[model samples]
Target: QKEVEQDPGPLSVPEGAIVSLNCTYSNSAFQYFMWYRQYSRKGPELLMYTYSSGNKEDGRFTAQVDKSSKYISLFIRDSQPSDSATYLCAMLLYGGATNKLIFGTGTLLAVQP
Candidate 1:
């Protein structure tokens, strides 16, 4: 089974809305979870990173992880037009010599003006 599962959505919302993006994992070994935002024709940029499990908030964004449930989520508050992008959820396990990020199929979001 795929380690991580995220809905590959073309989710649309109006400006100033609160958006919730989510990902679920099947692997219990994942220790590092991250959320990345990628603009069209641009590279993915890290938005939030969590070690182990906890809730992390920065500015208008918040990331939550529940290791016991193997679920992680990202919340965008006061969503703006600039926030329209593809959001990726990634996880890392430290066993391999060269650990690589396992990313979910990105979810596309559009915030209308």
Candidate 2:
């Protein structure tokens, strides 16, 4: 199995719909989970970062990590067309300060008008 697995979703929804994105990893040594949002032709911007298992909330975004299950999820509440972007899930190994990131293939999300 790949170290990380995620569906490359081109998920389209109406404006204001809730969006859920998820990923699963096989590595247990990964300690940091991150979510990044990227628009066309642009590098990804960090949207969420969490160390270990738990949930973090910011504005309309929520990120959840379950180290035991090796799963991570991002929830976008009250989504908008402006929220349309490719979402990437990334992980970093423990005991690293260099911030080397291992990324999933990413899911493309589109919120229509």
Candidate 3:
């Protein structure tokens, strides 16, 4: 099974709405977590990065991580049409010489006017 799993959402919402994206993992060794946003035909861009189990907010975006549950979430406030894109959740398992990065299948979000 994949270490991380996220809903491949074509999750649609109205502009100015609150949007929530989530992911779950089966691995307990993951120590680093991240969220990426990908526009159509473009590469994923790092949106949030954290190593601790807590909530981190940057402007309208908030990322929450819970190590005990192996769960992570990203929240977008005041969703915009410009925010329509694919969201990817990633985790890193760091070993002395074998750090591995795992990514989710990605959730697609669309904000409509």
Candidate 4:
């Protein structure tokens, strides 16, 4: 099984709507969960990061993680057309000589004006 799994959704929403993105992982060793946004032809940028199991909010974005259930989520409020992009869920396994990072397939989102 993949360490992290996310629905590759071409999800469409209207302006000002709230958007929810989710991912599930099989690795209990993951210590850091992050959400990244990637625009076409651009590199993925970190949007949110959460350590352990908890929630973190930044501006209109909220990221949540549940280590017990091995699930994570990202919520965007007041969606805008500019928010259209691919959202990737990533997890970091910290330990050993080197840390490891794994990413989901990514979910595509489009917000209409």
Local accuracy of candidate 1 as per-residue lDDT tens digits, 1-112: 7899998898999999999999999988787999999999999999999986789999999999999999999999999999999999999876779787999999999999
Per-residue C-alpha lDDT of model 4 across residues 1-113, encoded as one tens digit per residue: 88789988989999999999999999888889999999999999988899968888899999999989999999999999999999999998887779877999999999999
lDDT of 2 by residue, 11-72 (tens): 99999999999999998888789999999999999998999688999999999999889999
- CA lDDT, candidate 2, residue 110: 94
Query: What is candidate 1's local distance difference test score?
Result: 0.94
lDDT for model 4, on a 0 to 1 scale? 0.93
What are the RMSDs of all candidates, in order? Answer: 1.0, 1.3, 1.0, 1.0
Which of the two, 2 or 3, has more TM-score?
3
Stretches of candidate 3 above 4 Å error?
A: none
Angstrom error at residue 29, model 3: 0.8
Least lDDT summed over 10 consecutive residues: which range in candidate 4?
92-101
Candidate 1: stretches off by over 4 Å: none
CA lDDT of each prediction against the hidden true structure: 0.94, 0.92, 0.94, 0.93
